[model samples]
Structure formats: structure tokens, C-alpha cells
Target: MFRKNFIMSLMENILILFIIASVFYTSQSLQTQKTIYVPQGSITNIISQLHKKGYEVSPIDRYILSFLGQPQSGWVDIGAEKLNRVDFLYKLATAKAKMEEITLIPGETALLFFEDIASTLDLDASRLQHYYDQHADYPEAGIYADTYYVPFGINEEQLIAFLLKESTGQFQKISQKIYGTYDKKQWLRILTIASIIQKEAANTEEMPLVSSVIYNRIKKGMPLQMDGTLNYGKYSHIKVTPERIRNDKSRFNTYRYKGLPPSPIGAVSFDAIIAAIKPAQTDYLYFMKNRQGTHDFTKSYRTHRRNIQKAR
Candidate 1:
């Protein structure tokens, strides 16, 4: 009878353990059913927001996960994941530690860049622009130009610094690669010229050739005659008007100006910067955009005039 009682007790203990395991599994399953999105908010606020969004979470859990001696590895290990389950708070807290990303594409002006950062990263565009305008200084207008990747929650000043750092690094790399030396001052000048060429070139394929033409004209003491510069100085967009092109008194009016404009007109790409430093070795001094998105190049004034007439 004692042996029988011992067996029954062992069976009862196993049953209790099974019940406990079942409860734990159910709780975990419920947690997986919720979804949460934590914006730029404090841990407590984030938890409350998650709870309000129907997640099974508590402020204490978030506090512990975010700050209270929790291993950073555990907190951030969530990685990038979508919230498909109800127990989204834990997953979100884990995922929130993952770095968010922002991408800046080519040809993006300062205004557009700020807008994209603001919209994508939940930043204030005007405030960021103000910071850049006040703190960021380029050798010329729109000197820094390229694609940039910024992590989430970065401030205005930090973002500007990142861009400046990126520009510096890129300039150094390009200068060393192409010119065999890095000269900040001279490279800034070349970048200024490249920026203008970037705005003028009809397509990427024409950038090197257009750069060659500009170099040739400069070598011959001829006016650059870039309509894009005049358009930038007078118009809000790059679209050139006949009147603006005809009546060009602005400093950016390369048609009237004898040398490089006071500053760059727009953002330039790495290719443009490279082209500026190492222009194609050619005698071509003129280019006109055709409907095929390529330019008609000319080596002499007579041929250029004929091409212009044909373009018209």
C-alpha cells in the first residue's frame, strides 16, 4: 500500500508540472498576438502607448528591458522584425534597440533632403535646416552632395555633422584616387565646378564630355556659358527661360561671367567630382542637348553654331 501511495504521488506531481507548463505556453502565445509601435518616446510612454494599442505589456517591463540592468544584447537582439503577434511589446522593445535607417538619394537638394529626413525619421525639417544653415559651412553653395545613410533618433546637428564627415571622407578618397593627393582647397574649387557641370549635363553619359568642354573653354579664357547657372540664380528650379538666359547679370550667369561662378549651383555626384578633377582629354568646347538625352559636341565655333541651330 505504501508503494502504491508513492506511485500515485509521483503521478500527481507530474500532472501539476504539466499544468504549469501549459499555462506558461498559453501566456507566451497571447503575448505573440499583439503589435506595438514605439515612436520617439520614453520607455514609460512607449509602454503605455503599446498597452493602449492592445498589447500585453507593462511599464516596468519596458523600464527593465530598456534601462534597469538588462543586458544590452538581450534588449537589442530583437533585430528588425514585423509585429504580427499580440505580445508585440517584448518584440518591439527588442526591435526598438535595432538601428533604424534613413537614405538620402542623389540630386536631393537641402530642402528636399531635410523633408525626407523629417518624414522618414520623424524629425523636424525646419529645425534641421536651420541647424545646417547655421552650423554647416561649405566652400561654396551646395558643396556637399551625395547619398547618405543616417540612423534613427539623430538630431539636426548630428545629422549635419554626419553629412559633413561623409563629404570630407569622400573628397579625400576621390582626391587620392584620381589626383594622387588630397588638396581640400583645390578640390573644393573643382567640386564647385563639378556641381555646375552636374546641373548642366543632360545625362550621366554626357557628364565627362560636358566636363571636358567646360575645361577646354576655361583653358581658352572663354565664358563657360552654362545656362543652368543663370537658371539657378534667377529661377527657383533648374528650368532655363529665354528671357533669364538673355538678361544675365547675376553672378551665377556663367554666360556673362568669365570664370567659375562664385559658388556651386546644386548638389553634385561623385562622378561629377571625379570628372571635374580628371576631365576627358578632348578639344570639344561646346555641347547642346538633343531629344535623345545626349549632347551634340563641337570642337569649333562654326560647328557649335550649326549644332545650336539644328537643336533649335
Candidate 2:
């Protein structure tokens, strides 16, 4: 009976010691960023990574996290600059990353878009461009012109990959839905035309008319001679000049080369894409910007010249 009582007393003392140690461990202060990226991995691997990053996590965290739940992969919100061990571990398994919205307005070039993203996300602009160059199949218009919500701490490569992957899926879905198949080569041609329309049209309503003029001009073997075609890459907002037209010998300079530009000039909207695929049934061969800040389209060069004079 004495031996049994001694054994029970020892067990009770051990339990009390364990409880005290747990309390001390959980109460320790931890410093972390407000936002952090959590890679996809096992619980132990995540704990090790956190330790490597100077976060005070350990093997104990792996056990604590097992009951809390799986750690969320991607950017996560810690929600505080300093937290107790338990709270930090709990947040690792629970909190969602804060998101910021990025809108890619139609007709904006990828160069400008990457610049905007770098500025907004506080990332390296060159790295963003590098990742884009590495992943994108096309030189431009790989991402659709639309708004996107990304996590606050997303890195350059992940952001570029996400945008490209999302755009590719949507592109395929739209193509398959409309044409019953997705042909990348033919689709790129459509995108090139759509990009031209995106740059030229004053509004969504004008897209189909502009598309018709493009087709009519091409059918008649006339040069596109569009000012918008010159507004490519670094010259997205720069005014097309008479000197520019005379000097530019690239395929993008429609006055110098026949057919569509070898690639898209800028990003395009769904409306522009739709218009390119199905243009208005008209014999329009020319368009000039009128005083109303819209185009006056005509088949006759005489009428177009008169419109240009009226605008001046």
C-alpha cells in the first residue's frame, strides 16, 4: 500500500510539471511580420522553415498545430506584429491573407501593368518582368484585361504564374465555348485584331464598327495605317507623329507593312475580342477622329478627308 501511494504521488508531481512547462512555452512572445507567405509542406517542414526565417517556432509547434488544423498555403495574415506562441500557431492554421485589388484597364500594355503591380505590391519590377518573360507564351496580352485580387505578400514569380495560368484557362474556356475548340495560333490572330480594336474604339459600342473597317481594309489590300498600331510597348500613351510613321519600318507600323501586326499591340477586353470574331457587315475602309471624340467611319477617302478637315 505504501509503495503504491509513492508511485501515485510521483505521477501527480510529473503531471503538474508538464502543465507548468506548457504554460510557460505558450506564453512566450513571438515576433513576426503582419503578412507572411507559407509554402505548401508538412507541419514539421513548415515549423523548420519558420525557424529558418528567424521565427521562434519549433518541433513543439508541429504538435500544437496538429490539433489546430492544417496550415494554409500561400500568403497568410498574422494580424499582429507580436503574438504569444499559441496565438501565432493558431493564426498560421486559420487566418486568411489580406487581399488587394488590381485592375488592368483594357488597352494598357503589359509593361505598364507590371510597373503598376510592382509599385502596388512593393516588389521588384524587373523580377516581375523576368518571371513574365519566362512563363508567357506570347510577348504581350497573355493576361486578360480585367480586375484581379491577389494576396498582399505574393512574390513576383507566383503572381506572374497565377495571372498567366488563370488567363490561359479563361482563354481556353471562351474559345471552346464559342468555336467548339481552342486553337492557340488562330486565337492569337484574333487577339491581335482585338488589341487593335481596343486601342482605336472610343467605347464598347464602337468596337464592331472598327473591326469591320479592319476587315474591309485588309480585304481591299489597303494598309491599316492606324495610329493605334504605333502605340505599342513603351509608346502606349505617346502620340503617333508624322516622323514616327515615316521612320518606323517594323511590322507594327501598318503603313510600312501589310496584314495585321505580328502580335497583339496591347491588352484587349472581351468586348474587343468578340467584335474581332464577328465584325459589323459594312464596307467601311477608313475612320478619322471627329470633334465629338469618336470616329467617323466611311468607305470613301473623300468623305474621310472631309471629316479630318472638320476635326482640325
Pairing residues by index, what is the TM-score of model 1? 0.72
Quality of model 2 by C-alpha lDDT? 0.91
What is the TM-score (0 to 1) of candidate 2? 0.84
- Identify the leading candidate in terms of TM-score: 2
TM-scores of the candidates are: 0.72, 0.84
Global lDDT of each candidate? 0.66, 0.91
Scanning candidate 2 in windows of ten residues, the lowest lDDT window is 95-104
lDDT tens string, model 2, 43-142? 8889999899899898989999999999888788788999999999999999886788988889999898989889999988889889988998778898
Which pairs, if any, clash in model 2? Answer: none
